[model samples]
Target: ADAQITSAKIISLDAGKITTGSLDAARISAGSLTADKLAANTITADSGVIADAAITSAKIASLDASKITAGILDAARIDVGSITVDKLHALAKNLVNNYSRTSDLTGWTATDGSIVTDATLSAPVHRVTTTTNRQILSDYFEVDPSKTYKVTLSIKCDSADGTRYFGLHAIDKDGTSISVIPFTVSSRTFGGASSNFYFWSKGGATGGWLNLEAYILGRYIDNQSDVPEGKVVTSHCRMPANCHRIRLRYLNYGTAGTARTSDHFSPTVTAVDSGAIRAENVIAGLLQSVTGNSWISLDNGQFSFGNGALAWNGSSLSAQGTFEAVSGTYLAKLDAGAVKLSNSGVELGYFSIQTAGPTGPWITAAAGASKINLAKLVGTGLYTAYQIDWGTTGGTSATHRFWGTVTLNENALYSGAIDCGAIAADGVVSCWRVEPHLDNNDRCGTTTKRWQAVHALEGYFNKLTIGSNTCWAAGSMSLTTASWASVSFGKTFPSAPRVFGQYTHDFTGDIGMLKIRNITTTGFQATIGGSGFSGIAANWFAILV
Candidate 1:
């Protein structure tokens, strides 16, 4: 009853006529309230004038953390690198080396192309402009089938065509290869590369080509600390159970059967949850199992393999093959029976090489059980140049030693005892002192074995070439029942030699006189006019004139 005026009488109420505290927000009409009509400082959050849903981020130009209340911020709203690797998944490591090559291709091979490099590049850029289909291969290394591997590479194509391929080959223990998975040129996802691009492996079947997208790992980035290059391509591979060794390969096909100019950069291979790889190290047990020419172990330490077997045991060394020492035309080797030295095809068993420490290897006469014995091998027969006389007078032709031109540089000394054997010297025999002269003693050298060791002395029928008409070459031959036969002059004469012919008969009738002709430096001709002269023998001598 105080006002009793309801209805249309209150249609024009002036703000000056009503008290400020009398009207509340709910009493006003809902559609009539607008942002521009609101008075500054008139509405407070505590006054319940503005609803929470009515204010949005679009409505606020500036915001402070103190102004934010009651809700958590989304992860997308957080800054980058705010987290660390302790917050990420582990068990992954880079398996391939030299992928980001600053210099050489240590673990990679330019199988079909040459290595290309640049100064400004952080990695190598192998260009494939040389071959129509260029290929690159990684080191053939051991891998475990339980692990999953990833191969990533970034490529820039200057000129492109045809198709590019990535392949994974599985190798057996014997080095046999198996194609586990392949991205061949016959089947590829992308067309001829004409521009620079970034590729990806965004969730696909195993061995299938990855889908291409403009965005990379960050496309679905959830963690602030997770960062990766956007352009590098990645492919997945699982080592087959049949595989023993793993090898990664890439093949680049060109455009229109012509090689394209493309640069491949930072090709990498990675493995997840891989424990360790079996590699060669200090152990020789496994290496010894390998047959063909490999480093092996000995009793003392280690050594490499050669053609022969060698062993060293502290102070002693054992060699199996021929212990040979050859210089100029002189050869000295240790045989099964004796130690021998040969000069100008004249072999003598009298010396051996002994290792005397600091003095190195020196030639010494074989002593102890290795007694010096002169022996020579002819075909399947062994000939002893010196032999002991069986208590006989005349020396047998079996023990008749043959002598040739021997140039003795110095005196030949004899200190050790020598058995009863002959030494035939045809040329100059120069010596200091030679004892055990069998020419005087019957128990020592036989009469046929020993010589009356002379000094500056000329004896016997040795071709000495005394002066005019002296031929220093002598040999004997017979032409008994034939027309003609040849005989050697023993030494090449300076010219044709003068001949002296003599005939002898062993009680039988004498044959025709022997004739000599066709004189050459190496040999001369001996002929006979008569036949059936078997009973006669001719003793001819040629003297150089």
Candidate 2:
């Protein structure tokens, strides 16, 4: 009748029905009650619990400060969030090996000077009793060539001596001084004057040593008051690179017997935190020659050289094998040392080549309204096509325009179509050919005569007469008596002219019948004798065929 449990039999019990007293410890097998089989909040200290060593992170659901005892969690067991910048900085390693002078001067070397531990100053001091300058160098050190380092040092003068010059020098592997930062002290005061000096240098193979030097002046002491007591003086130098050595040097420039002292030489070398290695495709050195298609762009400008092509910034776009415009079109090109402009592209209208000789420029143009128009456009107005100007001086304002052919060498004007209002020539003879024709005159019963009028120096006349001998004659003569007078008509009529006539104004009588006796082409004779004619003046006559 009682509830019976069998081996391998599964039974479900009420939440509060099961009790520890109901089960026997000897009958319960080891590891028989799993975590899931246990009821919540059932396992307390008063009841029963697992062993302390048996409880792990997997066994514990969560934990708080109250659950964890003090000093139980170490740095490894603590969360990283609990750590702070101050703690990390406290644990940082100093890159400087001998930052403090507490140790002996084992890694330092003094040139022309001696470095000794001074008990009075509680630091290492470098002393130079000689008038000559001395230097102290440190042991060998290494540096990353691509890194930048800051070197700092402190200098203090124990005795007020002559003017002193101290400097920090960076020495290359070949013992060449690459850089120096100098500190000058004009005069040292009685009390020690300490100065903190700092310098920067980019690390490389050549920059292997950091050195310190001092120059002591001699013989120029005006008084003992100006001289400084030589005792414990110190210098401290610090740099980021693993340096070869620190050097302390003394320079004697003046009289002898001048002593110098320096102490507390501590140096700090720190590397600058530049986030990442900046690598660039920069052309190093003085690029004498470049061979492939490579471009480097910086700021707003771009430079490229390759395949016989070059470009500068964005002003030029195309770079096949030469310089070109943005549209892949060439305006000019340089090939094999010769420069040429495009002929089929944009045309250059006018060009000029000036040289020492008589060679001229070669200009070519396409077929069209191609021409070279030279003009000075002052304002909006029409201008003449061609204007030839002449002047005796620079300011002479005389110009001539020719619409037809004008030969400059021969001084000739062809086409014979001159619109000159008046003409003045310096020739011995000036000729004019005129077509004999009247306006609106028909050829019917009208003579269309053609003649050439010539003016010679012998006379001036408005009308010309040509005789059968081809002699030209023109004149107006006056007669005084009826005697036969030689009449000068410039040229005589041929056969005394079959028709002759005479007219007189001063004579009132018949003027007698005028007669022509001599008949020649060069000259003629005329006589007037009828009654009542005493003299004749202003006589006009003509002998016509």
Error of 1 at 355 (Å): 99
lDDT (tens digit, per residue) of candidate 2 on 1-545: 56686645756657596555666788789988899987899887656565556667797787777866656666788786987654542113323334344344444553445566656556655544444444455554444433434444444444444334433444455654443222222333222222223222111111222243222212122233433322223322222232333333223222235654444355545555232223464444333245546555555556666742666666765445444333355355533333345445653322335222566663322122233333455588645555534333233343454443435787433332223322323433332433233222322334454444432122223223333333334455555454676765555455454323244233322234456676565566766545344445433333434
At residue 89, give the lDDT of candidate 1.
25
What lDDT would each prediction earn against the true structure? 0.49, 0.42
Error of 2 at 31 (Å): 10
The numbered model that scores best in TM-score is: 1
RMSD value for candidate 2: 24.3
Per-prediction backbone clash count:
1, 44
lDDT, candidate 1, 428-528, per-residue tens: 44433332233233433234444454332122223223232324454456675555677776666778876555443333322344578887777777766
For all predictions, the C-alpha RMSD in Å is 23.5, 24.3
Off by over 4 Å in 1: 1-94, 111-122, 179-235, 257-259, 274-545
Model 2 earns a TM-score of 0.21
lDDT of 2 at 236: 23
Best-fitting candidate, scored by lDDT? 1
